[model samples]
Target: MDSTRKYTAEAPPLQEVQQTRGPLVLEFGTSWCGHCRAAQPYINEAFTSGPDLPHHKIEDGKGRPLGRAFRVKQWPTLIFLRDGEEVERLVRPADSASITRAMARIEQN
Candidate 1:
């Protein structure tokens, strides 16, 4: 799977996400979010080394069901999943190290 960079306004249904079978990264935030923008570099850096990882850059806001399903209360929340189950998460990551660590956890699966 490709590592997605652009945030899509459309997100997959919660059920579809839960049914996913491999390592996936769900990033919840909006293009207009300052924290999200600031975190992109580190996010990109991490993904550069994760070519096989499937990533969904979901645009999030009020009334967005996918974000709500994850109980996201902050921008730039990275949820790492293995076999459709959450393994790690980072909120507003400050550097690539933390992001890499979370990615590693999921990549191991």
Candidate 2:
């Protein structure tokens, strides 16, 4: 997956994406968010280190169903899941290390 990719305004249902096989990273953020843009490099680096992992950037804002389901209250919320179950979450990560650490959890499971 391309780490620098932009999220769409509409996304596949959260439950549907969760049902997908293997490890998945669901990133909730808006394109106009500064925090989201700032974290892009770190997010990209983490994904670069784990290329096989599936990463979905879902545009999130007020009333977005997926974000609401996850109870997202901030930009750049990265939810890590394994086998359709949430394993970890990082909100507005300050560095690549944080993201890498989260990825490690997914890798271990």
Candidate 3:
């Protein structure tokens, strides 16, 4: 994985992502999802800050291993985790601003 890019698929391992003080940001959606596709660029941009936190993507729809584990019900849901525990989540985010804001808040906690 490119260190500077937001992941478009499976994110870093949970333990690795939680190693930092900052929270981990995950984009859980498949490539075919329109909303997920749209969110890609912004998700990439969010990583530009490179906040020293882990950023990952798990591209799965229904019935897949990761999808079932996360219990994702919508496309393009952004899940934030702190210390391996879910901290914030936004489904089909209204905009990148909201997603980034959520990340910032989660990182603070």
Q: In model 2, how large is the Cα lDDT of residue 22?
A: 76
Candidate 2 structure quality by residue, lDDT tens digits, 50-99? 64687889999888998999999998999998888899999999999988
Candidate 2: pairs in clash: none
lDDT per residue (tens digit) for residues 1-109 in model 1:
3434578999999998899998889999988899999998888888887546888999998999999999999999999988889999899999988888888888887
Indicate the worst ten consecutive residues by lDDT in candidate 3: 1-10
Against the true structure, what is every candidate's RMSD?
A: 1.5, 1.2, 3.6
Better candidate number, 2 or 3, judged by lDDT: 2
**lDDT at residue 20 of model 1 (Cα atoms):** 95
- Each model's C-alpha lDDT? 0.88, 0.88, 0.66
Runs of candidate 1 with Cα error greater than 4 angstroms are 1-4
Model 3 Cα lDDT, one tens digit per residue, 41-75 = 66656655435556567766655555566678887
Q: Alpha-carbon error at 2 in model 3, in Å?
A: 5.6
